[model samples]
Target chain A: MHIDAIQTPAVLIDMDRAEANLAMAQDLANDLGLGLRPHVKTHKLPGLARRQVALGAVGVTCQKLGEAEAMADGGLADIFLPYNILGAAKLDRLAALHGRVRLSVTADSAETVAGYAARFGPEAPLTVLVECDTGMGRCGVQSPEAALSLARQIDAAEGLHFGGLMTYPPLGHGPETNDWLTRAKALLEDAGLASEVISTGGTPDLLRAGQIPVATEYRPGTYVYSDRMQVAWGHGTLQDCAMTVLATVVSRPTPDRAVLDAGSKALAADTCGAPGFGHLPAYPDAVVTGLSEEHGVVDLSACTRKPEIGERLRIVPNHACVVSNLFDRVHLMRGDEVEEIAQVTSRGALT
Target chain B: MHIDAIQTPAVLIDMDRAEANLAMAQDLANDLGLGLRPHVKTHKLPGLARRQVALGAVGVTCQKLGEAEAMADGGLADIFLPYNILGAAKLDRLAALHGRVRLSVTADSAETVAGYAARFGPEAPLTVLVECDTGMGRCGVQSPEAALSLARQIDAAEGLHFGGLMTYPPLGHGPETNDWLTRAKALLEDAGLASEVISTGGTPDLLRAGQIPVATEYRPGTYVYSDRMQVAWGHGTLQDCAMTVLATVVSRPTPDRAVLDAGSKALAADTCGAPGFGHLPAYPDAVVTGLSEEHGVVDLSACTRKPEIGERLRIVPNHACVVSNLFDRVHLMRGDEVEEIAQVTSRGALT
Candidate 1:
């Protein structure tokens, strides 16, 4: 099917642009002599993950076990889940996934490590990365000492391999992040632990991955499909964005206001300091003033040529990762024609 | 399955609370001698829509043809789609639906009316409501005169039936809205056109619906599952909220910070003048400070009690309608027991 033949409020991925993005990220990682591990959360399609692997990425990073299971089912060998896993239901699934592939997970607390130790044995070990809070304050232990304490617990556990350390760096602060990681690695080495890998992730600071003193690998998710937030952070221009929501102007209620079929449902509501929900590439000055459930109210007052009713527009969402989770399937577009329709297999896999 | 057995980041509906909320709205409409048309966009489940019909709803209001089709498939006869129907693809589906159900749609302009007229014939006419801008500036004709002009166009059209006027009124403006509708109905009567159903909708103003002198019917969507937005609007207290997002505490990165498994993907990013994304009943003073794709960072600084890892918490989302569209299925809970797991059958059916 052609791109226009598809329905409105649909997810359209420019395959060529996506492939170019993949090549660029891999090239940067190669130039830095660091292993590239792209996060599958950005584009949860296994086809894309396989392409990333085929294009020299060592493995993939997943935030949830359901995502890891989906990728493993698609024959992905190495997978890293960088979130604290708790509860018997999740540990059971994690153990099953661990048996299928070379699995690694992150932990910042002793409780999470103990849960993993109870699930797996020494013969069949799971790599555990001590997640550190360099600066981003969302997850991970507070300091290098806290990270070493978690690493010690993982090393002392029965069925866990103390892999290394990982941190999701704050944007535009590569040097300070590197110093933190280096200090943590030095502490781990002094404690007679081998820091096999040091994983750092931030798409905005991806190109500066080489500068991180002891980092052996980098994981970038939004680098696969740069969005409005990424562009706002100066990661790349709008030209680097691969994913765009194909929406049609459904209601022209007034001369300055046009409503598109795509709203919070299609484009998602993750506004990373962007003025509106998404950026309309066709109308650069038109602001997505408001969003209801299925109506994107666009202010066309700034546009010299406003879009008419039924006219299609491509919208770059505020955050690409959240947008991917909104749709069940996405149209892989090769120019104006659709190459394939891939199901977002890991969508809503927040278990 | 029990309520605790369901996975994290799941949508849970208190069946008793839901039934009570439904009865309250139905009783209000009955006392006012107004036909109640509950908008199915909130629940999107046929079972719930059936319950609404069983209680007192004259029909169900839908925002899209796809939703109306889903309701029609579930044995719902009267389905009002208050959206501008355009394009041959949608009109074809609309024509088929018009034959199967007692279909009515809204028109804000001649273009939308022409599309409906071109699809249907006089033998099987489609009801077209002149959507008037009674001040909610989303999708409606600017004034009552424009509404009257569109009504004349619908009356002249061969395949259309001028049903009446409809307005999604701005909150707390019942008096002004009634005056606008009264004048529009008076002008229609002066022009010798029958205004059959003067429909108005707004959950915040649903209780004041009877005060709208010319309104014969009322449509209320979010009242079935009152959300944080409704509570903020002073429509009802938090106790009246039926739907809540059941999420698990995943991580405690700091003394004042905890993360839940639900984020934008689960709880949604729609902030209806609320400071946070959703309201936590357990931690009323706590704020959902930030949200990533799969993690909601809760600031527990103001709380005396903080949620522990693996502990489940119920969250009242900002907008119930948008939250309903985020999940594939919702858990219907009767106290602590899971009565049913109903599929959101009309989910992502956006054409």
Candidate 2:
């Protein structure tokens, strides 16, 4: 099938561009001598996860247990969930998943660690990594001492093994993140805790993974489908973006305005500190000014040529990860030909 | 099932509140002597749409044909899709849907009218409303004259009927919108084109529907499930909100910081000119500072009390309509008791 054969307001993944992106990220990890565990949250497809594993990835990282379960169901053996798992329901699910595959999780607080310790037994231990707040300040232990405390707590738990550390560092703060992780690793080492896996992630600073020498693994989610956000941060160019929203011009209401069928529902409401909602590669000067639920209003005044009614245009969204989560399936295209239509297996896995 | 038994990061629709919201809107429309056409884009549930119809709503409004198709499959007889339907694939779907239900659509351009004219036949004529731009400036004919011109074009078409005029008017511009629609209706009358239905819609100015006396039908999507946006626009109070995201406090990294499992994927990244992504009734002063894919970072310094790890929080999202589209299933609740878990049939019906 050709690209035009598909419906409007659809997510199209350029297969060639996606494969090249995967290969480039894998080569970077190999050159940096770091284990590459691509986060499946970007694609949320089992086939894409398998492709990453086949490309020499150590494992796959899932932000939610539902996503991890989806990956495991797709035959992914080694999976790491770098999230604080709480509550009896999720813990029960975690125990079941651990029984199926090699599982690892992270914790920033003792409350989360206690829940994990209660679920698993020493006979079947679960690797628990202490999440360190290097500089992101989202979800992690406050300081190096706090990281040591969590490591000690994980070591003391009967069913838990103290796996090194994990951090989703702030963008462009490579040196600061590296320093923080180094000090935390040294503190853990001084306390006789061997840091086995120091996993760090951020797509913007993915190429600078070598700066964090202490990080044994690099997990980059958006690098597989670089978006306008990655391009804005100088990670890659528009050509590197594999995913684009295929939308049709439903109404050219004004001479300067053209509305597409894609809106916040299709493109998402995420802004990467950019000027507009999305970038139209065909009309680079045209700005997607605003988005309703099902209408993307484009300001075509800046362009020399404006799209007419019924014209199809592909839009590069600001964020790739969130956009993937919005759709149920994606059309994988090889240039202009449709390769496959894959279900986003973990699309609404928000448990 | 009890609300406590359910997992966190879930969409909970308070059935009592939802029913009350539905009744209030219907009563208001009845009192104002206008045909109520509730937009199902808010709830996206067939059962809820049925409730709206049972409460004397003339029909349900949909923004996309996919939504109308889902509603039709769910046994909804009347649906008004106020969007420009283009392309052969969509027109084919629209024609099929028209065969099943009482369908009416809007078009702003002759190109769209031509597409409809090619598909439909006079034996089963399709109702095509001239979409007028009443200052919203999104997808509609610019002037009242343009609306009449489009109406004349629809009248001339072999398979289409110029049923009426439709406008998604600009918020808080009731007088200007009324003037635009009134002039357009007069133009249609002067041209011997009878506008059977003068439809106008906006959740913020729904109460002022009576102000547009020329409008025979009123469509309001968000009034069925009032959100923070509606509250910000002074449409309803926080207590009037029906849909909320039940999220868990997964990490309380600092005394002033609390991270939730519900982020953009669960709560959405839409802001209604408000300060934060959501409003936590439990902690009114707390602000949701930022959101990652699965992490909602909350700043709790302003609150007198803070949420601990594993504590569940019911958050009213910024926009209810988009939030409902994010989840696959919603737990309908009646004061802490789970009533039912219904599938959002049109959750990803973006086409």
Candidate 3:
């Protein structure tokens, strides 16, 4: 597509690359006997989620109820909201989704489960998976006893159904992970209750998927849009990444530094440990030194070649998931041509 | 409006507070005898820009052609883009805008000015201002000689008019600001030219604005939407700040921290050296320790109160300008009541 025809600071998706990445994950899941639940939160594009289902994903996973509702609206029959639902507002929305689609949600505390129960009503029991703090200390119960306590509360409650256990484990490799999962499973098994499903995964930990043998399902989001952080962290190559931010050089006021029109506004600033604003595939060495509201400063002094002002450049954002959440829609491109403008159905589904 | 009706991650602008802030800034500018050309890059809200104009602004300052178009659509008559315009496409867009409004743009290099000349034609000469680097090393020419050289290029060009001196003088309050503007004016006046319009201002340096005698205009974006940084850096108080992100606690897996539904998507990750994803109005001491794509972790272990799940909170974004540029529309409200959903008229005017 001619850069001038498209608006500046837009998200661009390569259909071929996206499809290939989707297929790769499906084949791996099928071969490994793992249920593929593609996290729709990464793309927030219903079309991408539909493609994942078509490629053999068991269900779509979302981080918020609003996102799950959007996916359901997009015709996904099965969805899992892997986020804690707290208020009556979201619980009401979740109840509505549960009635429409085959829905399951997560909860870490008794208060949250009780709150959901209060909203879902006594007769219409809502499915809930107890969350366990595997290695990520951000959320979930620390011990299996704590998990069972919440699970048992749900099991006894009138308006709640125990669906199993879930955890967003730390992205790592080797016996440390193997040991942790094994112990977690042992603890659950000793509780005299078999977990119908144990959900575990993230794009960063895809390499170590083999270690989590007890996990029946994997929820990987960034695999579909592998980015600078993924490539730098040794997760995926640049070509394997499907999504990119198409930006133009708005100002190069000096010889050493140039600024792009896409700043954190387009990028969303979830660096995820990457070194720059976004990667310039054509010029890999350039460093995005600073970002103002509408301006991104790229220090190209280190590069062998100079990039001119008004030049269109593809930036693989530091965090692909956050980048996907930035735009309302992204152009689905096939090579150098525009194919479609797929609405990001879950763009602002933060609730 | 019921907090539930106000969408999660939606920006709520307090009209009364916003009007007061606008009045204060315009009053400050009037008292100082400086032309108040309020920066449109901050609000990107036409209504706010009009209110500034009504408060006695010389003209509105736009950062992009699309922004200028939006302002013109809002019935604004004049705009100033204080940055280099590159490429035939962008220059053409600017030329088109000149028909609807009086447009004045900035250029730092000779090549960019030449492109402007090529695009605007003879009868539609583009109004030009040379952007200079005083202390903020982000953009503009380095020395007074360099500014003079670029100014001469604009003067020599067929479709370009030299429009005096401009500099986004470094962010802090100091004597260097006056020193640089004075020296730059001397250099221009020595070359048989007078610096008629001197434009220089940033929110941090607003208190010291009177120091620069040559500066005839002041452009400050963040004064309208003061944020956490502004409050921390002594720019404004929380009460004086007019905009905030209203989010819900979506996750409270641990007693120490809880994650909110509004992550980088709502906050825009514009952390300007302040702590936390956002500050809870009721709990300012809380720290936002970490943020995922859809989850913001608020640490309240040390604070006197813990944010329960489903609790609604207001966040003063790390940086306000970037947050303003994220959405298609911003909901204007007055004390828990949403009034209108105003389109960001210039949401993605990157080029």
- Of the candidates shown, which would achieve the greatest DockQ relative to the real structure? 2
Candidate 1, TM-score vs. the true structure? 0.98
Writing each residue's lDDT as its tens digit, candidate 1 over B249-286 gives 87898989998888887788778777888899999999
Candidate 2 has what TM-score? 0.99
Per-residue CA lDDT of model 1 for A5-63, tens digit only, reads: 88887888898889999999999999888999999999899999999999999999998
Q: Arrange candidates by TM-score, highest first: which order?
A: 2, 1, 3
What is the per-residue lDDT of model 2 for residues B1-351, given as tens digits with 9 covering 90 to 100?
Answer: 999998879999988888998898899899988999999998889999998999999999999888999999999999999998988888899989999999999999999999999999999999999998888989999999999899999999889989999999988888888898889888889999999999999889987777788899999999988999998997979999999999999999999999999999998888886788999999999999999999999999999989989999999999998888999999999889999999997777689
Residue pairs clashing in model 1 are none
Better of 1 and 3 by TM-score: 1
Clashes of each: 0, 0, 2
Work out candidate 1's RMSD over C-alphas: 1.3
Per-residue lDDT of A84 in model 2: 95
Selected candidate, larger DockQ, 1 vs 3? 1
Worst 10 residues of 2 chain A by lDDT: A341-350
Distance from true location, Cα of A136 in model 3, Å: 0.9
Candidate 3 lDDT, B310-339, residue by residue in tens: 778888787777777766678787767777
Predicted structure 2: clash tally? 0
Q: Kindly give the stretch of ten consecutive residues in candidate 3 chain A with the minimal lDDT sum.
A: A173-182
